[model samples]
Structures are given as structure tokens and as C-alpha cells.
Target: MKIAILGTGAVGTTIASRLVEIGHQVMIGSRSKTNEKAIEFVQKFDRNISNGTFEEAANFGDIIFNCIKGEFAVGALKSIEKIIDNKILIDVSIPVNTKNGMPFTLIPELCNTNSLGEEIQKNLPNTKVVKTLNTMWSTLMMTPSMLKDGDHTNFICGNDTEAKETVKILLKEIGWKEESIMDLGDITGSRGMESVLHLWWKIWGSTIGTFSIKVVN
Candidate 1:
């Protein structure tokens, strides 16, 4: 599969490297074609991995991974809206803002009633958007098994049933089991998932450890 990762940050680079390791074609998309981080990523990986501007990467991918920071996501996608039509977009971003050097915080206007996932979906009505992996760190996003026993849970939500199923397969490839993945109905459910980040931040600070949630029956 040809995948486009729309950010050159830690999350996007980590996801792109993993996908490339798994034999998928990956392009790290950034605002500039000469982005130093993006260039370094391609030089570090095999020929199957590359880098480009946002629009160029969008045009190159069969599936687009919106890995940009939550606050910048909509504007980034809008820049390449024409090329991403009908593509399945796996959104793993959270709408977080940092204030006065404080720990990460969610944007008040985009939480509860609205979420980054829904906003992206609304902005790109023609794109198939599925939300997942926003609740955990980028490393854990692909290697959940690194944690003790890997029994933790992850959530996904999207209006398109088919798109969700497709994302499920990709999740499995990265070590998520069917039983460990919870589908919380449609896109609206993202509100709950996004909200979980607040608690997640607190937990991360309290324990100073890597952890994720598990849905116990």
C-alpha cells in the first residue's frame, strides 16, 4: 500500500518508518520539499520510503495518514484537498495546545461538542476518515506488545463501515488484535476518545510510565 504521512514530526516519522519496515511504500509529507527532518527520514530508510511537500505526498498515496499536530491538521489537509478526495484517511492526531510552557492541553473550542476527527471529516467531506491511535504515544501506536502482555485496548470510530474495517486490518498488522480494538460506533464517538487524552496526560505525568487503556468486560 502507498501511504502518505502528513507530518514530519515524531509521530509521523515513527509511523512512516514502521510502515516502510512492513514493506509498504511511504512518503513523509511536510510543508516544504526540503524539510530537514523529512530529508533525513528518507536518507535513513530504504528506497520505498520518500519525502515530499504536502500536496505531492497526498497525490502519491493510496491511503493518507493525518499525523500532523491537532491544531494544524485542518489547514494542512485543506492545502491538498483536491488530491485526497475518496482516499481513506487514518487520523491519529489530537487537538492539543501548549500554554505558557505548560503540559499539553486540548483546545477548548474543539473538544466535547467537536473533535479533531470530526473537524477533518467535515472539512474534507469526500474523504473517508477513520479515527484511531490518538489515545496513545506514537511508539505504542505500532508496538503495543512492548507493554506488559499487550492486553491493553485501542478505540476506533468512523462513519464509513468499510473504511473502519480497512483500518482494522492495518491495526492488526501493527500488533493490535481484533479483541483489543473497540469500535465506538460512528465519528461522533471520537468525542469520548479525544476527551480521554485529558486523563491520559494526567496518567502519564503521575506514573511517568508508558501505558494504555483496556476495556474490561
Candidate 2:
């Protein structure tokens, strides 16, 4: 699968490396065109990684992972508006106010803090946006081995049935089993995911450390 990760930050870098490791064409799209540093990072990480401008990466990916900071997400997306429609976009963003090494979720009038995922869906209208990978830290996004107590959950929510299934398939490809993943349902359900970030942080800071949660019956 050709996967495009926007933003080139920690989350983007982690996801890109994971996808590349298991044999996928991965590209990193940044605000800046591929610079020497970007080239070096990608080359060092994996030979499969291609760095490009926003529009280039959007069009290059079969599925685009929007990993930009929430504040800049809208504009960053708008820059590549043409290719977004009808594509499956997995939004891993949260509205965060990072002060003193902590991020607090913002309160939105209608949609709460998680609406950025749905908001992107609403604005794009044609894109199939599934909200996932926002609950846990990027550390566990790819490597499930670090999961402490081995009991953690990654939540997904979306409106479209087909889109949700598509996302589930992708998640499975990344080693998330169907039962281990919880489908919260509908884009509005993303609010719960944002709240889980609080739980995730607390767990990370506590005894659990970098482990994950799995729902077992």
C-alpha cells in the first residue's frame, strides 16, 4: 500500500518507518520541500521513504495519514485539497495546548475537542475520514511489544461503514487484530477518543509505562 504521512513530526516519522519496514511505499510530506536534513532522515530510516511537498505526498498515497498539529491541520490540508476527496484519511490529531510538557484537550462549542477529525470530514465532505491512533502515544503506534501489562486499547470512530471497514483492514495490517480494536462508531464518537488521551497519559506516567491495553473476554 502506498501510504503518505503528512507533518514529518514524531508521529509521522514513526508511522512512516513502521510502514516501510513491513514492505509498503511510504512518503513524508512536509511544509518544506525535501531538504538535505529530510533526505538524510528518510534515507537513514528506510530506503522506501520519499519526501515531498504536501500536494505531492497527498496524491502519492493511497491513504493519507494526517499527523499535523491540530492548529495547523486545516491549512495544511487545504494546501492539498484536490486529492483528498473520496480518499480514506486516518486522522491522528487532537486539539492540544502543549504547555509545560503536557497537552490539555480544548473544548469546542459543538464537537468537543475531537471534531478536527470530523471537521476535516465535514470540510472535505467527499473524504472518508476515520478517527484512530489518537488515543495512544506514537511510541506504541507501530511497536506493540512495548505494551506494558499488555492491556491497552486503540479506539476508532467514523460515520461511513465502508470507510470504517477500510480502516480496520489497515489497522490489521499494522498488527491490530479485529477484536483487540474497539469501534466507537460515527465521527462524533471521536470525543471519547480525545478523553482516552488523558487515560493514556496517566497510564504512561504511572506503573504501566509504555505498554498497551488489549480487551480480552
Candidate 3:
């Protein structure tokens, strides 16, 4: 798969590195991609990843992963809306503004955690949007274990079955097995799933240490 990574932060770098390691063509998109780590990535892994602007990455990818922050995620796509027709978009974003945020799902989901995924789904009506990878820290995105493998839980919800399946395949390639991941039905569930991140922040941001929730049989 031709994967476009739309941010060069930790999440984007981690995903791109893993995908490239698995022999996928990855284009990393960033505001200024020629900087230190980006240059090092190009030099270190010549065949796997190529750096480009957002427009270049969007056009080059068969599947687009929007790993940018929630603030920039939608705008990044809109800037290149013409290029993202009918493509599978994997959104790893959360909608939280520092000052006015509450829990992921308060009374009526009233937290600053409004529906970021739904917003993206709305933005690119033609594009299939699947929300995953936002619930956990980047440490466990593809890898159930560690940097790129092991056991972890990441909730994925989307309106399109086929698009969801495609993400599942890629998830498998990234070492996620059937029981390790869950599908919470449709894209709107991201509103609730994001609460996991808030819970995580409170724990980690405090001193609760590394914590994970799993479904027990």
C-alpha cells in the first residue's frame, strides 16, 4: 500500500517507520520535512519513505493516515481536498482544546472532546473515514507489544465496512490480531473512545504508570 503519513511527529514517524519496514511505500508529509529527523529518515531508509509537502503526500498515497494534531487535521485535508477522492482515511486524532475540555464523554459528550472523527467524515464526505489509534499513546499504535509489535487495545470505528476491513488488514500487518482490537460500530464512537485518552492522560500525567484495558473472556 502507498501510505501517506500527514504529520512528522512521533506518531507519524513511528507509523511510517513500521510500514516501511514491512515493505510498504510511505510518503511522510509535514510542514517542513527537510529538517533533521526527516533528512535522517530519508538517508537511513532510502527505499521505504519519501518526504513531501501535505499536497504531495495526499496525492501520492493510496491510503492516507492523518496523524497531525486535531487542530490541524481537518485543515490539512481541506488544503488538498481535490486529491483525496474516495481514498481510505485513517484518523488518529482527538478533539481537545486545553482551556475548555472535560472528560471524553461527559453528560452529553459535552467535553471539549467534540466529534473530531465525525467532523472529518463530514469534511470528506466521499472519503471513507475510520477512527483508530487516537485512544492510545503512540507507543502502542501498531504494536500490541512495543515500538512495532505485541499486545494492546485500540478501538476502530467507521461507517464503511470495506474501509474498516482494509484498516483491519493493515492492523494485522502491524501485529494486531483479531482479539486485540475492537470495532465499536460507526465513526461517531470515536467521541467515546477518545475518553480513553483523557483517562490515560490523567493516569500518566499524574503517576499511575503504564496502564491498559483489555476485554476479558
Candidate 4:
């Protein structure tokens, strides 16, 4: 499968590298063709990987991963809207505000009542947007098995069933178990997933350790 990763940040790089390692053609996209991170990523991987402008990457992939920061996600994706029609877009970004100090904070305008996922879905109505992995660290996003016995939960929400299934397969490829992935219904459910970041940030700071949620029945 060909995958396009927007952002070139830690999350984007991590996802892109893992996809390439697993034999997928991966493209790292950024606002500019000369983005340092994107260029560095292509150089580092050197095989089965490429870098390009946002529109170029969007046009290149069968599946697109929205790994950019939440604050800038919509705008960045909007720039490539023409090329991403009908594509499955996996959004793993949360609108976080770091200016408040300490454990960082979420921008109320973009979260809580309204989430970045919902906004992105609204903007790109033609694209199938699935929200997942925003609740965990980038490291765990690709290697969920790092947790003891790989017994943990990850959530997914999207408007299209087929698109969600495609994302599920991709998640499994990156080490998520079928049963461990919880489908929280359609796009509106993303409000809950995005809000979890508040608790996640708190727990991450207190424990000083890496962990993921496990839904026990």
C-alpha cells in the first residue's frame, strides 16, 4: 500500500518509518518541498520512501495519514483538498496549547465542544476521515505491543465503514490487535477520543512512564 504522511514531525516520521519498514511505499509531506524534516526523513530511510509538497504527497498515496499538529491540521489538509477526494485519511492529531506551562493544555475552541477531527471531516467531506492514535504517544502508536502482553485498547471513529476497516488493517499491521481496537461509532464520537488527551497528559506526567488505555469488560 502507498501511504502519505503529512507533518514530518515526530508522529509523522514515526508512522512513515514504520510503514516503510513494513514494505509500504511511504511519502512524507510538508508545506514546502524543501522542509528540513521531510528531506531528512527521505534521506534517512532512503528506500521505499519519498518526500514532497503537501499536494504532491496527497496525490501520491492510496491512504493518507494526518500526522500534523492539531492547530494547523485543517489548513494544511485544506491545501491538498483537491487531490484527496475519496481517500481514507487517518487523523492522529489533537489541538494542544503549550503556552499555559507545565503539562500543556488543549485549545478550548478546537477541542471539548468541537474537535479537530470533526472539523477536518467537515472540511474534507469527500475524504473518509478516521480518528485514532491521538490518545497515545507516537512511539506506542506504531508499536502497541511494547505494553506488557500487548493488552491495551485503542479507539477509532469514522463516518465510513469501509474506510474504518482499512484503517483497522493498517493498525494491525503496526501491531494493534483486532479485539483491542474499539470502534466508537461515527465521527461525532471523536469528541470523546480527543478529550481523552486531557487525562492522558496528566497521567503521562505523573507516572513518568509510557502506558495506554485498556478497556476491560
Tell me how far the alpha carbon of residue 5 in candidate 1 is from the true structure, in angstroms, after superposition. 0.5
**Alpha-carbon error at 183 in model 1, in Å?**
0.3
Candidate achieving higher TM-score, 3 or 4: 4
How accurate locally, in lDDT, is each candidate?
0.89, 0.77, 0.79, 0.89
Ranking by lDDT: 1, 4, 3, 2
* Stretches of model 1 off by over 4 angstroms after superposition: none
Instruction: Name the lDDT of candidate 4.
Output: 0.89
lDDT (Cα, tens digit) per residue for candidate 3, span 1-217:
8999988888888888889988899998887756566667667786868998888888899999988877677788877887887999999877555455664423333234557788788888888999987777675775667632445577899999999999999988988877778899998787877666667777776765455666555
CA deviation > 4 Å runs, candidate 2: 35-37, 99-103, 107-114, 148-151, 213-217
Per-residue lDDT of model 2, residues 129-152, tens digit only? 889988777868776546652246
RMSD of each: 1.2, 2.5, 3.4, 1.2
Worst 10 residues of 1 by lDDT: 97-106
Residue 124's lDDT within candidate 2 is 79
Candidate 1 global lDDT: 0.89
Evaluate residue 22 in candidate 4 and report its C-alpha lDDT on the 0 to 100 scale: 88
Scored against the true structure, residue 201 in model 1 reaches a CA lDDT of 78
lDDT of 4 by residue, 1-217 (tens): 9999988899999998899988999888899999987887699866899999988999999999998888888888988887998999999988887667766677777777888889999999999999998889998989988887668999999999999999999999989999999999999888999888789878887786789888899
Better of 2 and 3 by TM-score: 2
